[model samples]
Target: MRLLPVGTTLFVVLTLGACSPSAPEVPVGADGRTDPVLVQGRDLYQANCVQCHGSGGGGGRGPQLNGGTVAASYPDTAAQIELVTNGKGAMPAFGGRLEPAEIEAVVRYTREVLAENG
Candidate 1:
């Protein structure tokens, strides 16, 4: 019979324990969009962003985002995606915490919800 070394068994167990499942992401469609994403994004932003950006994305601890100020300069989605994935100034990198799908949805939500008003 084969047996794993004690160290190997411990390492395997620890790794599995450390890597827990994150909150499930709202699924997007083939067209690559969904209102559910917005809802999820809203929930995420409320939990994660409201303290800094304010409930409406107005400037608080963070700068105002509801004015479409951030999204306008991005020539494409990639640029915006990069900024979010990587930490910039006060913004912490959410790369490990938020799945790529959630990030994309948040970006879309920012455009859809934050662009229209103050």
Candidate 2:
């Protein structure tokens, strides 16, 4: 006879489900920037963040972002913007490549995506 624990099965199922590729955030707010920001953020993240941060915003070669890393490292959104714009240790600055608006959009996307996953 085979015995399967309930909790173990549930954990296995959840782990499998979470392993799938993350879809972009849809059904954004009325403002194009708000929701579209997440969609655009997904693109920006795929292009930039994925190299370091995991596709799901989890830690990779760098550090985990879904936690308070940004909030702790940067005082506020502006600080995060500054870091992303200016770059930090090992991380390259993206200011020239992306416009301020695009940066904000990607920031919003990161936060939203983190929230959804967390």
Candidate 3:
């Protein structure tokens, strides 16, 4: 059996860890270009939502939105939109910081993209 040197094994492990995959990317448009709204949504989600909701919407400090949870919870998109616009309990409101359209984009991203993944 061949044994790797300690430093070499450590280097390999570190490299592999660095190469670990991130969450799946949002799908592209029929034109082969990424949807602008989804792109904006993803950026907003990473900046605002990732802290509480896991990158994949698997939930951390926040409730899980993945695996169709968001859809099930708020069958009416407007309800979710309202919740995001108006702060609820521990969840801080984004309405003051973000434009209504931007809020809508993020909501769409969560329901359509992140929710589908986990």
Candidate 4:
């Protein structure tokens, strides 16, 4: 095979690096549970809630969802679903934007993952 020019080789390397797939954004939490549903929920949260809720549900524009905050406020999952689906106060309604399954996934993520960790 013919040798590539130095610049061409460098360009190829850089292009390949850029095209490389990124690591999974959802990491297995300290709990060591890697259930597919929870992972999916984490992914959903990152995509939809991270902007306002902060990374790991630490809170930012939206109230902190970690620890017992959400649990204490909305003990019932249905209530949590309502709050998320309809939105309240500063939180915008997600009912229109996300599917019912997506909403359920996020709720489970917040309750099971974030709350457990907190």
Q: Rank the candidates by lDDT, best first.
A: 3, 4, 2, 1
Candidate 4 lDDT over residue span 18-109, tens digit each: 77532134456678857777777888897788788876677889998987789999989999999899999989899999999889988888
List RMSD in Å for every model shown: 12.2, 6.6, 4.3, 6.1
The candidate scoring highest on TM-score is: 3
Worst 10 residues of 2 by lDDT: 23-32
Which stretches of candidate 1 lie above 4 Å from their native place? Answer: 1-34
Write down the TM-score for model 3. Answer: 0.79
- Residue range 19-39, candidate 2, lDDT tens digits: 876634544466645565667
Best by lDDT: 3
Per-candidate TM equals: 0.66, 0.67, 0.79, 0.70
Clashes of each: 0, 0, 0, 0
Across 17-114, the per-residue lDDT of candidate 1 in tens digits comes to: 86752222344557887678787787777666767777667758877777787677775878877878886899878798899988887777666676
Lowest summed lDDT window (length 10), candidate 4: 20-29
61: Cα error in model 3, Å: 0.6
lDDT of 3 at 14: 97
Tell me how far the alpha carbon of residue 25 in candidate 1 is from the true structure, in angstroms, after superposition: 18
Q: Estimate candidate 4's alpha-carbon lDDT, on a 0 to 1 scale.
A: 0.81
Q: Candidate 3 — which residues are off by over 4 angstroms?
A: 1-23
